[model samples]
Target: MQLVVKPVPDTASNQCLTESCAWHGFDTNPPFEDIVELHYTGYHEKKKFASSREDLGEPLRTEIGTGKVIKGWDEGIVSMFEGEIARLVIRDDFAYGAYGYPPMIPGGATLTYEIELLRIEKPTSNHKLKPSH
Candidate 1:
């Protein structure tokens, strides 16, 4: 399936260079290596449902650092910082495609997620919550 690329606003207006993404330059400034803990509020849109029983409104509370989820969460979460809010426009390639969610995400479907980075935590050898880098 062909993935439709939704142009980010800054990039679409030619306001920034490709090497430096305008989206990356937002208020969010978490370190690249820091593990991002976030609370995202968004919805998934597809032609059909991923699950026959589950509704589409089921919000996803993902702990991104553990690599326990989809590729979009893995990549998108790292690009945000504590308290940063982003409107993520995801393509089918980044989400469950072709054979969707066993039955919510459908094949060749696109999804959008409005994400908010609520917290950032640093891993420390000591038993203290290390300051965000």
Candidate 2:
């Protein structure tokens, strides 16, 4: 699969990855961190596989730079501002890899996602939130 990322004009934002994956989006003031809530549409082989839209109940929440979600998502979601949307394309190595994720994902498959940043929440105190496994 092909991966591409480039600067978006005068915006300080830039592509996150360009080898195994690619992402294009804007940067937030505080940057994506400790925790975030967002919506996403996941696609495999150009077919809709999963999503976290409004109709799908609560928006998904996760900690950044943590292995809580797929590697591709971690690399792509950072630095994105709330209300910003972007496309993240990832190869197998950054996704579920050769073993895949059961029936939802296949071995060595390339996946794409249309992710929208809904909110960013920083920790209230100095205590850090533990990364969910």
Pairs with steric clashes in candidate 1: 49-104, 50-104, 50-105, 51-104, 98-107
Per-candidate count of clashing residue pairs (backbone under 3 Å): 5, 0
Residue 54 local lDDT, model 2: 43
RMSD of 1: 9.5
Per-residue lDDT of candidate 1, residues 84-121 (tens digit): 55655555666666665644455765565555565665
**Model 2 residue 55 lDDT score:** 48
Residue pairs clashing, model 2 = none
Alpha-carbon RMSD of each model: 9.5, 6.3
Estimate the TM-score of every prediction.
0.52, 0.71
What are the runs in model 1 whose C-alpha is more than 4 Å off?
1-34, 46-66, 124-133
Question: Which run of 10 residues does model 2 get worst, by summed lDDT?
Answer: 12-21
Q: What does the lDDT come to for candidate 2? A: 0.64
lDDT tens digits, residue span 52-123, model 2: 764467677677766777776776666455666667777787788898887889999888877777777885
Candidate 2 deviant stretches above 4 angstroms: 1-33, 124-133
Error of 1 at 57 (Å): 13
Evaluate residue 84 in candidate 2 and report its C-alpha lDDT on the 0 to 100 scale: 64
User: Which candidate has the top score in TM-score?
Assistant: 2
